[model samples]
Target: MSAAPALASLQALFARAVVAGEDEAVLAHLAGDPETARRRLGLYRRAILANQAGALRAAFPVVARLVGEGFFDEAARRYGEASPPARADLNRHGESFPAFLSGYPHAASMPWLADVARLEWAAHESLMAADEAPLDFDALARVEAAGQPCLRFRLHPSLRLVRSAWPVLAIWEANQPGRDGTPDREEGADDVLAWREAGRLRYALLAPREAAFVEALARGETLAEAAGEGEPWDFGTMLGRLAGAGLLCAFSRGAAAPP
Candidate 1:
């Protein structure tokens, strides 16, 4: 075989060994006479495993604390092996971990664990989402009443809405530091909206109607149509809340005139 193909095959074999948790097999594949090659490969595997574990642990510190260090490490190792990082960005590494935990056998006992992870992931995503200018309240105030019907409101780039069957917000709060009271797993369902405001991640529980309105708008519904879908979707209340939370980015006074 050509040198290139031979080297590629060797690299693939090494990768498989690392992924399969077969360190001995990997050591055997290195140059038989060069003891240093086996040592170096082993070191490389250790470093890679450590890096992967650290990235996941950082993203899910609350989950790690909930599951205990040992259990969390084993679970993270298995997940890392199954779904190795495909991108260079470490911040995006644990995006699928919540879903994975939901189906994992060990986590089956903690039914709320997955939802907690999901909440944390949403917060993390909101913090990293693209930044945008806040809505121009002054300009909006100046728009004529005749142009109001044609106006289209825009949402902030950092805004995110998540609705969960479980009380994810309560679960998240229960896990937060300095929470003096006992954790209440049965706190109830939640509809949460998160966004980056003033360079900090901020979130609040949304009412059913408010959640519906925001979700509808996210799907490109005009304000009027979006409001129609929810309970009186009090435009004044929704706009005030969103604007206060920095969720409104910009808005156009009128829809694009037909070409």
Candidate 2:
């Protein structure tokens, strides 16, 4: 193999050894004695797992608090072993943690825990999403009335929707530091709207119809189709509400769907 490919293969093997705790394959490639290499690999494995757990803890503080430190640590370790980080950006790690919690034996008792984790991930993603300039109303006004129906509206890059059978938004809010850990009512559904506003993360509960409208637009539906999703509701008012909230980022007069 060429130097580049040889180095790449070695790096991949090293990552697998550290992440999967299978260092034997990598021992032969190291410079030192096998025992010393094993010792160094063990240290690397511990440090990698610790860093991954720290990243998970940072990303899912609400989940960590709900499960307590000891439980969270064990769970984080198992999670790291099961789904090792595929990217260097640790901030983007643990996106699958909510799904992991759903099937986790210990977490089954707390059925709502997974959804809460999902909401937290949404909040994290919203905060990390790239910023975009708000929609240009003048450009929108220039489109003729006949061409408006097919116009595709672009919501803000940070906008995210999380639908849960449990009142996850309330649960998340109640668990905030210094707040009483009691949600208003625990038995109902919540469709949360998470987004970044003025550099701060914000979340709110969305009405069912409003969610449908937004979701349709998110799927690259045209104005006519999205407006139809909320029948009997004034599309103008709905559009105005989203635009006023700085949620509408841009628009395009074409049939192509959003990338």
Candidate 3:
């Protein structure tokens, strides 16, 4: 085999050894004592899995709390085995954990568990999103009235919307540390908004009309279309709230795009 291909093959085998616990194939390529190499590979495998599990634990603390640490650890191990890290940064791992839990037979009893995980993931993403300057309301006011309807808006980069058939917001709040793990009312749907502000994570349940309006905007709908989603509702008040909370980041007229 060519030198480059042979080296790439060796690297792939080593990765499988450490990530998939497949040691036998890679053992033949080792230069040192076979037994020693096997032992070292085993140690590396365990460390990699441990680091992955730690990342999952940090990102899904509420999930860890819902399912005890023992169960969470096993689940994290299975997740790593099935879908090993594709990137070096552990912080970006476990994005599909909520989907994994959805089909997890052991968690069938708690159908809403996946939704809660989704909420947590949204919060994690929001916290990691890039910072942005707040919307320029003065520039917006100067736009001619004729151009208002065609104006598209940009929500904060840190904003995330989560909708679930279960009362996920209530469940997430109830599970917070030192709080009793009981939701005030547990039998309804929830539309939630999670975002980061001033270096802190904040989330709240959004009213139905408000959720629809914000969602329309997030989809890049113009102001007129977004307003239509919440007809008869006071959009001026809603816009004010968004600005006050640092949610609206920018806007554009017609085909012009926000930076």
Candidate 4:
């Protein structure tokens, strides 16, 4: 083989050995002597495994607690091999872990595991999402009544909406450090809206109408159009709750209509 192709195959083989916990025969072609090459390969394997485990653990502390350290460690090891981190930023790692857990054999017993992971991931994402100012009510007040139809509102950059087929909010709350006093699991689902308010991550469980209302607004529906999705949407109550919770960030007098 040409030098470039040979080197590329060697690199790929090295990565496979380290990530897949495979035999170390792949290192025989390294430039160094056989002994030196094997030692170097071993060092690379250890570092890769350690880094992957560390990142997974950091992202899923609650998962670790739920499953216990030993079980979680083994699961992390297996998952790391299957879905190695593709980015240098560890914070963005485990973005697909929630989905992974949903289908994992052991996790099937605890159907809520996936939803819990979803909630935690949402909080993590909200923390890193871009920041935006709360709605400028002052700007809205200055607009002409006739201009209301042209106005477009924007949600806060850190705002995130998650709807689950399980009681994810209750599950998350019950798992909280001091919330051990709650009753045993019940049957139901919940829709959660999370956002950063006053520099803190805050979340609220929304009713069907409320969730639909916010979802419509999120899709660029105007106050009038979005409210239309939820008949008798109680615009005053819904808007008041959202504004109070800092979900709405800013509004303009006129902008493009909803898609």
On residues 144-252, what C-alpha lDDT tens digit does candidate 4 reach at each position?
A: 8786755666777777788888887877777677766253567667899888877788999888778877887787777777667434747668777888877777675
Model 1 weakest lDDT span, ten residues long: 250-259
- Stretches off by above 4 angstroms in model 1 are 1-5, 22-40, 146-150, 229-233, 253-259
RMSD of 4: 3.4
Ranking the candidates on TM-score from highest down gives: 3, 1, 2, 4
Model 2: per-residue Cα lDDT over 91-140, one tens digit each:
98899989999999999899999999999999999998989878889989
TM-score of 3: 0.89
TM-score (C-alpha, index-matched) for candidate 1: 0.84
- Number of clashes in model 1? 0
Better of 2 and 3 by lDDT: 3
Clashes of each: 0, 0, 0, 1
- Return whichever of 2 and 3 wins on TM-score: 3
Compare the candidates by lDDT and give the number of the best one.
3
Residue pairs with colliding backbones in model 1 are none
lDDT of 4: 0.75
lDDT of each: 0.76, 0.85, 0.87, 0.75
Against the hidden reference, what TM-scores do the models get? 0.84, 0.83, 0.89, 0.82
User: Candidate 1, residues 1-259: lDDT per residue as tens digits?
Assistant: 1233467777777886656645554455555554676666667777877788788887787788788888888888888867778998878989999998999999998887887788788888888888887777898789888866555667887788878888888767776777733567676678888888888988888887788888876666666766774345367688788878767777764454211
Can you give the lDDT of residue 197 in candidate 3?
A: 86
Better of 3 and 4 by TM-score: 3
Q: Choose 3 or 4, whichever is better by lDDT.
A: 3
User: What stretches of model 3 exceed 4 Å from their correct place?
Assistant: 1-5, 31-36, 144-146, 229-231, 255-257
